[model samples]
Target: MAKKQDNTITWDTFSEGLWRENPVFVMLLGMCPVLAVTNSAINALAMGIATLFVLLASGTLISLLRNSIPKQVRIATYIVIIATFVTIVDYTIQAISLDLYNALGAFIQLIVANCMILGRAEAYSSRNPPLKSIVNATGMGLGFTLALLCLGVVREILGAGSLFGIDLFGPRFEPWVVMVLPAGGFLVLGAWLLLFEWLKQRKSETELNPASES
Candidate 1:
């Protein structure tokens, strides 16, 4: 019984963040970056990729040293490891493109302070194996990215009448300027949450009365 209870599957760890415990939509852990950079699809994509890299790297390292880390300073130690990855990502972005680096700005460095990363480090990775930790981190990162994209798409389309900086609608379309503003972030997020809840309820109803549908 002990053995069975203690065991975990790698795939389970990876899939949990997809829907069951999504960092952005479900868990709502890292809102700062999500709301700040999601005005455009490209910005959201850049932020997502940068976050994914640091999360996987830090989670792997932290899991590898879980047994050795002193309980007295585990939080501090995790911060250092996370900061190291953030630094790497920061410089890499700067080297790649000055414009992108300027766009993402301090949010890249602020990944160290993102509760989602640290939460996963302490809650899942620290207790799991390196492979499991990386998988879980990847799942969570992907979930966050997907959520960002959802908002980015809607805002970019409505606010700028474009996607990825290319105009989808001709000059006749009037963009909703508010969609690009900070308030648009809240509005979009709230709409998503409402949709998620509605779908969840529909699923629940289907499950509760499966015979009727058949």
Candidate 2:
């Protein structure tokens, strides 16, 4: 049998989810929305925050019910919980502003389908206490938000000469219309992945060959 993890280890697990094993930049899970909704920084931020709220709430709830839930139906139960939260977020956004809600479109509802939420419920929440699950969910959600923000910044700057709806570049700036297109999303994401891989390799090499050790 696998050894049980100490509760203290939850912090490490939680922090790693935010950056080291980020679902978007590192693990590369839930790329569809990341690419689709990042045309503007506002949309990206809205989506990220919505996802974060759902993830935290669902994780905590799932962890609380872990023992009581039958193992066979746990996945289904978790999905239902997650879907309910997503629906709440969806309506909340719609009520706040129809434009923003329309900007996000079906992607808001699709949060229920995001693998990160379900994966967390099964892999982390089901195995840990409610507090730890909340921490983990927050970390993972933040990581996802960070990645989306990065993509949104890149796309918005190149496509619209703006950042979060604020014009940074003047009229002289000629926006690369393609940056707002589907092809541009893929290109930007691909380049970001390559950059991440390169940095990770460099970090690994530096750690392996530190001057003090040498």
Candidate 3:
């Protein structure tokens, strides 16, 4: 369906990734970092931004070179391109803040293997112009980042009584403890998935019977 388009930039192309086709929430791609590194809002935000950068950079480059590349070697080329950007992010993070760098750990390097960026390269960028690809990548990256924040913010607030390390409640507030654990990632992600699913279903019903919403 995407290939059928004339590669024009439209709001749908950008907004689809933010909601309708969100990489994390809707498509469930790149769950590794989504669940592993999102225990805190800061970590989630940092990871989201990093992924967004890689996506935008790699997508733009891939779109420019798409026509010249052999179809058989495209995937390898995509990975190399993605890895170059990931390396830049990984080192930049390390130089900026060792704490954040350690917090994210190997997951930063793993962005190379993230299916979300590669999928965009193969599916959207390769078939579209650079401008359209940039718009699409921006939306998709934000969507993925938003999904991470959804899980991270809730988990951090409940688990640590904080948001981005700021104490929200007080010393009197007892943290959930579990919210910061590996298990917390699963619980939060599950709850979010259910909520999004319900919302989607409700939207479908409303669209099918417009009067019902009124």
**Tens-digit lDDT track of model 3 for 153-180:** 9999999999989999999999999999
Across 1-214, the per-residue lDDT of candidate 2 in tens digits comes to: 1135877655666677777688998787888899999998999999999999999999999999999999889889999999999999999999999999999999999999999888878888899888877887889999999899999999999999999889988999999999999998999999999998898778768795645421
lDDT for 187 (candidate 2): 92
Minimal lDDT window, size 10, model 1: 1-10
Model 1 lDDT tens row, 1-214: 0122243565767777877788898888899999999999999999999999989999999999999999999999999999999999999999999999898889999988999999988887778888777878899899889888999999999999999999999999999999999999999999999999999788878796746532
TM-scores of the candidates are 0.93, 0.93, 0.94
Give each model's whole-structure lDDT. Answer: 0.89, 0.89, 0.92
Alpha carbon lDDT at 21, candidate 3: 86
Candidate 1 global CA lDDT score: 0.89
Error of 1 at 34 (Å): 0.4
Q: Alpha carbon lDDT of residue 42, candidate 3? A: 99
